[model samples]
Target: MAATAPKSLGAGEGAGNIGFDRSGIAGESKGLLKVLDTARKVAKSDSSVLITGESGTGKELIARAIHRNSTRRNGPMVIINCGAIPSELLESELFGHEKGAFTGAHRSRTGRFEIADNGSLFLDEIGDMSSDLQVKLLRAIQERKFERVGGTQTIAVDIRVISATNKDLAAAIKEGEFREDLYYRLNVIPIHILPLRERRDDIFPLTDYFQNNLLDRSTDYQIKQFSDQAKQVLTHYEWPGNIRELENMVERISVLVEEVDIQVHDLPECMITPSSHHTSSSVSSVFNNGIGFNEAVDQYQRSLISHALNESGWVKARAAEMLKMNRTTLVEKLKKMHIKPEMETPIF
Candidate 1:
């Protein structure tokens, strides 16, 4: 047996160019497209962007996309996870410290903000930052100046800030856990990515991509395909962990499923018979609770519209025709249903 060569992306498929095909973004879902569009547009400026989404939705990847497309693309893009570091040490991590500032501060070291000067600073898990630190961060961001953890001399930085979080900052603010003032400061341009369950169209492409990329990286692993029934299980399953979970699932199957093909039985129990917390169970509950006719009609309409849009590849005009409704009527339905991207997609 021999390893297969990696399949290169077609022309203009890479990120920050024609589309967001780069960085494992792999998908054609409406939500994915809207996310890329927003990120690329904001990348041109030095605005502070706050990205919101469920964990494992690729927030860091989106941040990198923005930094790569920005004017400071050539400069370094420093990233720091606020939640990962302890409160006692996070200050030094962000602002650096001078010698003898703290017990472990043996010598002066540059912090993420200073390192990202004239570049981009990505603050992941901003929601988890301590309130006291948030105040300091706010001051530094507002003044573009900061005194390192131990140093008294102020250092000025010319950098763009991109922050992301899975926690609900609004709710945190109300709960007195997160600062509202800092929230406004960081949220100049807000971008949100829907969960994987809502964008079922992406699951297949992502599966294909993970398998192909994995094969390229691991010669011992042979190329693999998902059976139709397995694919159905994948798309129907509610991906509570979102994109990261899907990627992991593909990697797991590729590594452990000895066969070249993956069948329904190979899928995890979560995908086959989803649990009560899963959306599949929720759908069942919708019927079991004895819903009214009007509520049933609304639910069916939402599902119908979603199916049409997804079937037409989110070409609103085409989806409208498929549903035998005018474009404007479809638009209203989409709005009421909270559908993504108001405008109709242009033909490819």
Candidate 2:
């Protein structure tokens, strides 16, 4: 069974202020509701917001909602994937430069910040930013001013900064990988996203949504429904890639399976049998005749933890639900197992 919604939602009116229509999103889980609520409340304010979650958890959608709801909705909303750009050219990409600033500088170019004037700038995968660039970003946020690479004049921007990351920034700060001051500055209001596995109640709804909304029209395949057994299999199996994986699986089944209802046989091969679900079991049964009971238990635990972590994109709270444990207990288990809650590489 899926867990309850985050406790933050019931504490005050602010928790209940998520303005977006929950019915429109993929799933009907409490996690989805809470995220929408948090996004709504944060949207009303212009303060910097740092959205943290595993990849494919729809961080960009939340950012877009915030931008659309904010006072700057009429203006443009520029998105810059910090991890996608080369380190050498990031500075120029953020702050425009005059002609001849670099080898390929043919004309005066505008950066994301300048183009996003009177709007919002969304910096995705911000954890991958270099330390030197972090200093420049801090300066810009602190002073609301920045200068192009080769320009003499200072440009003042009236824009809101919204950043998202999939790394454990706190741990990064401890290791001196991320700057402490910069972290605090961007984390003015932090929003955490729950992964899909934690909210099993929303699985059927999400599957239906994908079938109705994302399926290709040209394909002659009719709408498919999940059988009760298939639903149980989905709920029990670990979702490593969160919603994106689920969406992909659904689309794949839609294309390959001819029937209107999806059964256990329609699932991917790895998920069909209980023994094939874990790496150790498949190895042990074939090579060692049978594995030790304790080793099997450990493998099971590891599989559960890994699945939950992947489904929730490594967010601890959501992973905890996927494991059917309390958040604090899950954190303790992670520590004991030496499993880091956050992904090492940036996942935005």
Using TM-score as the measure, which candidate wins?
Answer: 1
Give one digit per residue, the lDDT tens place, for model 2 in 182-255: 99889998988876655666677667777767776454556777765466567655566777888899889978
Candidate 1 steric clashes? 0
Each model's TM-score, in the order given?
A: 0.77, 0.73
| Candidate 1 displacement at residue 43 in angstroms | 0.8
Candidate 1 lDDT, tens digit per residue, 1-348?
Answer: 555665554534744447433455577777788888888778877899999999998889889878877789889999999999998889989999999998867889889999999999999999999998999999999989999987899999999999999999999999999989999999999999888867777788877777776543555777777765466457556778998888888877776789987876677656654345644454653444345567655655665676578678898899999999999999998888665532211110
lDDT of each: 0.78, 0.74
Give Cα distance to truth, residue 181, candidate 2, Å. 1.1
Residue 296 Cα positional deviation in candidate 1, in Å, after optimal superposition: 12
Which candidate leads in lDDT? 1
lDDT of 1 at 218: 55
Which ten residues in a row are the worst by lDDT in model 2? Answer: 2-11
